[model samples]
Target: MNPKVKTGISAAQTGLKAVKIGKKALNLKKKLPGEKKKATQKALEKSAKKAAKQEQKTEKKQSCRQRNRRALKNTKGIGRIALAIWNRYF
Candidate 1:
């Protein structure tokens, strides 16, 4: 196998190990006592806020059609520079 593939496998293994550790910690937290209702409420609110932001970003990406406008603006700027150079040297 190629050395790059081996390196990638090793990195992935390390990431999986970290994820397992994180999951174990979360499990322990769930088992250990506390106000369960409050924890559940906070978790739900955090997830809702995250989902809202993701939806907003997706909507913006879908409808924010500014690429053509930006391209036109850039061409206008280049044309000005080109004209100035031509006027100065020609």
Candidate 2:
């Protein structure tokens, strides 16, 4: 029922989606000639590593956004309570 809870759930869902998409994209399968197998495999490993690093960066950004949203929500609630108290006493 709380909007804050809804936002937290949405944030978790988005993170899961990002992880799933990243895993799907990194699922590489390519048929190569016997002579080029070693080189292709090496390249694939390098690319997969790069993709994983990028995915980590994206996940970090999403987590940061979620933290910021939660902090903002808490502050807004505190500010409203402060205002109510100020009005009642002054």
Candidate 3:
């Protein structure tokens, strides 16, 4: 942003600052239409990667929980069949 417009924003409302913005502007190159498509494709790829990471994280957590549950059942003298029945009904 132009410095003149930056300071004049708050001062404009009070009518105490000189507004000299919009007089001079930088000419920027317009983006190609194909550039936008590529950007969106990149964004979607990023989302898919993030989802895969989250799925792996959840899978790891579930496996850890299962291991802990098995250890608990074993410590309590619960048989495999009993554990399976308890898990199915509960």
The candidate that achieves the highest TM-score relative to the unseen native structure: 2
Tens digits of per-residue lDDT for model 2, 53-83:
7766776777788789999999999999999
- For 1-90, candidate 1 gives per-residue lDDT tens digits of 554575466557656655665575577567766787457546755655565566557545644545566788999999999999999999
lDDT of 3 at 45: 55
lDDT of 3 by residue, 1-90 (tens): 553564455335323211211111111113336666566556655655565566557656766777798799787775767888999999
lDDT winner between candidates 1 and 3: 1
Q: Which ten contiguous residues of candidate 2 have the minimum total lDDT?
A: 22-31
Model 1 residue 37 distance off true place after TM-score fit, in angstroms = 0.3
What's model 2's overall lDDT?
Answer: 0.69
- Quantify all predictions' global Cα lDDT against the true fold: 0.65, 0.69, 0.53
**TM-score (C-alpha) between model 2 and the true structure:** 0.55
TM-score of each model, in listed order: 0.37, 0.55, 0.46
Q: Which ten residues in a row have the lowest lDDT in candidate 1?
A: 58-67
- Alpha-carbon error at 76 in model 3, in Å? 2.7
Candidate that would win on lDDT: 2
